[model samples]
Target: MDTGLVGDRRWQEKIFTGEWRDGGGGVLPVIEPATGAELGVAGKAAPDDVARSVARADEAQAAWAAAPFSERAGVLRRAAELWTEHSAEVRTWLVREAGSVRRKAMRELGGTVAECWEAAALPSHPLGEVLPSERATLSMTRRTPVGVVGVIAPFNLPLKLAFRSVAPALALGNAVVLKPDPRTPVSGGVALARVFEEAGLPPGVLHVLPGGADVGAALVVQPAVRAVSFTGSSRAGHAVAELCARHSTRVHLELGGNSALIVMPDADLDRAVAAASYGAFYHQGQGCIVVGRHLVHDSVYDTYAQMLAEKAAGLTVGNPAEQDVALGPLIDAHQRDSVDALVTGSVEAGAKPLTGGTYQGLFYRPTVLADTGPGAPAYDAEVFGPVASVTRFSTADEAVELASDSPYGLALSILTADVTAGLEMAAAIPTGLAHINDQTIADDAHAPFGGLGESGNASRFGGPAANIEAYTDTRWITVHSAIPSY
Candidate 1:
């Protein structure tokens, strides 16, 4: 099988109807953020391509859905095996195409492999429950696939998010049309299709269309597409939701976050510093659940801030393929500019930089901001970069109030030795995922992962339970014995 990364022309083909074809949306250049060089060009899918892809997926849904659970599971397991076989190639693409550091690329590839295998188990997951009936009857509920699902993934962590949605949708016997960010299509989008195709996924059960917002909008409004799973900025997520609403389609969004890491007076300073540093700087702080705010208690705030600043300053920012580089370039110059603007605005608004507030090309330094006020952009908005805004609180109520003061309720972390205090603090916070004595960005394949409020639309996208919910619809049935009277 062709890996599809052979040349510029080969990269310009869309995965549609089980084969590659040059899409109508013309050619888009793929840039490597680390060096600001053109990696290659990818084919962009037009609106017509979107319609055709969805139509094909619609046609293929029934037969795929009718296939036995064991068969579907076998395909998914084979896909996982394929991922393992191609891990090195995928990791290289991630590093070059998406600006992911070696460690981050490895982690994402590993997670994608695990997610596929976990999705394979979705077929064996319980569908629904049997309920007692008032009369001499039996009542039970069952789940069915929601038909063709449209997945729109962002460039950051492209491979992981695409499979995070696509794998489960396929596991539940639903066809999928995935639109990956054009910038990282080869790494994020096409590679996925290669895996499934090699694993013998039926034609049209999975399609990859690489393009911009036009393709995504077309997918969202396609009549055959019953559901949408999106992961990206809150602004884009809201737009996707609104478009899906017009079609009366269900959408599961994993949007932006300004998660906070709270440090209590009795917290272990070393552990808190390490967790905060990793949470805020990992993946160049590009993750949605990154710890953007560090709320330290007044008692140890100065010491903690000092240690965090030292750690942030010591991080190596360079080419992603380098061995010792901890931070890589942002996805593009636009994102780097945005991060710079936010940092500059915060500093102008009375926030002081404790460690870093500089950039070279698309690479932004790991920054720690001190004395950030409520009105500062760094404190109020999602920076989506390697910048941690620190503020001090005197009491637990103040900590909770500060932590819960964001429009994004994605995730939060409470670091304290006392489990009781951590639990109490966790209960008070309004975020979706709360961690005691750990960072906010940790995810397990078996747990439900999503957010509340502006972070998402109450849709979970991890584990078998979430897959069952997102990819299937519940139907309740009742049967009366001996035709009992109503």
Candidate 2:
């Protein structure tokens, strides 16, 4: 069957144990949000397929773990090289399948390459520590790979997010069974398999199963799957964590976030506005760490709100493939409608719409809401779209309180010229990441990236140091040079 789709044909196959196969779960149509068109169809993995994938990963884990670190690192380096070499193709896939604007697509591709290279270097870095023993013996701790890992990646930034966990898991000598979001199976899942295979990765060391929630559930509960790394919404994260808990499997979750950006009176208006614009609307505010709340000091509240309104109105929204388009369409109609409902509910609750609160089809206007009080859904709930809700505060304490009021503590930004105030605010907020004089959405390959509370499960990802803790198990050993007389 043609599957009634358009775009790349390579995406039609499922990557099973090692080779492409027709999925037993049937076909899933990939829709492009930009024009509401069918981008392609992907072979979906069934529950049995997921189980087979886990078995293959478990079988491969032993040999891969026993392989020398240098050998494994070499393959990762090759994969990184291939990712960079095929950057153009990867970018196209992201734009068409993920509804990523040109710049966002480029950023994701670049980040994927960087993450792979970073993971490749993990073998050369210190993975363990030497400890002083109470007895006359040398004591040290060694980090060893966990067996098989189930990686459930999200649709937004699918390739980058998947690589965030997959590369590190592979670098640490763990076999991974990845289940990418069905909507982005080709760009997110299949492309990654191709990269690893071309880079000489051992067959069965990595498996890509493109499917929906059922496949993810199956992967999470398999006896051989010792750990799981998932990135998605809080509701889904909770479910996955609960499932893993039942099986006594370790799971790392990077879930939903309702971060805030606080603008103090001492902050430069231009810088604050720029920070708010980038933090709140970049990638159309679909990021987990995107600033959902904008808290402004009453002294500068009017000016900041006006400036932000103008900025939101000025942003261009159109086809994601267009170079100049600043905002792209939502992933699908469901998400678009959800965003609309949140905005509508907030407006009805007395939150004033400052600018751009409407939408046509999947492309929602960059929206800004002022006077959004505590009772309004937009004030506390995560919109997960191109929307920013502003609330004015009377004092520094009030600004901090408002920003820290949310149940989520993912990423927070405080814009102020006063270093002391910035430091004070950072100390007060309980988010995983905090920025002063910068946007909240920035991430580095060498930094610990994850969240707190509902945003994450207190587990860290990214960087060699953090991944060493996440993907490996620690064992303490002591050796005696001479026999002790008792």
On lDDT, the leading prediction is 1
Rate residue 348 of model 1 by lDDT: 93
Per residue, candidate 2 scores C-alpha lDDT tens digits across 1-486 of 122111335556545568778787998787887876776677889999988878888888899988988999999999988888777788887888888888899989888888998999987777778998888899999988899989999988999999999999999899999999988887788888878888988999999998889999999999999889999999999999999999999999999999889898889999789889988998888899898999998999989999999999999998877656989888888988889899999999999899998998888999999999688887778889999999999988988888888889899898988988898988998988999888888777778888899999764687777898889999998889988898
Off by over 4 Å in 2: 1-11, 481-486
Return the number of clashes found in candidate 1: 0
Q: What's the number of clashes in each of the models?
A: 0, 0
Taking all chains together, each candidate's TM-score versus the true structure is 0.96, 0.96
TM match of model 2 to true structure: 0.96
Q: Which TM-score value belongs to model 1?
A: 0.96
For candidate 2, give the lDDT of residue 167. 95
Residues 1-486, candidate 1: write the lDDT tens digits: 234333334445444557877798887787888887886676778999999888888999999999998999999999999889878878888998899999889999999998998999998888888998777778999899999999999998999989899999999999999999988988888788778877999988998898889989999999889999999999999999999999999999999999999999988899889989999998999999999999999999899989999999999999977665999999888888999999999999999899999998888999999988589999999999999999999999999999989999999999988999889988988888999999987777778889888899764787777889899999999977687555
- Which window of ten consecutive residues has the lowest lDDT sum in model 2? 1-10
Ten contiguous residues minimizing lDDT sum, candidate 1: 1-10
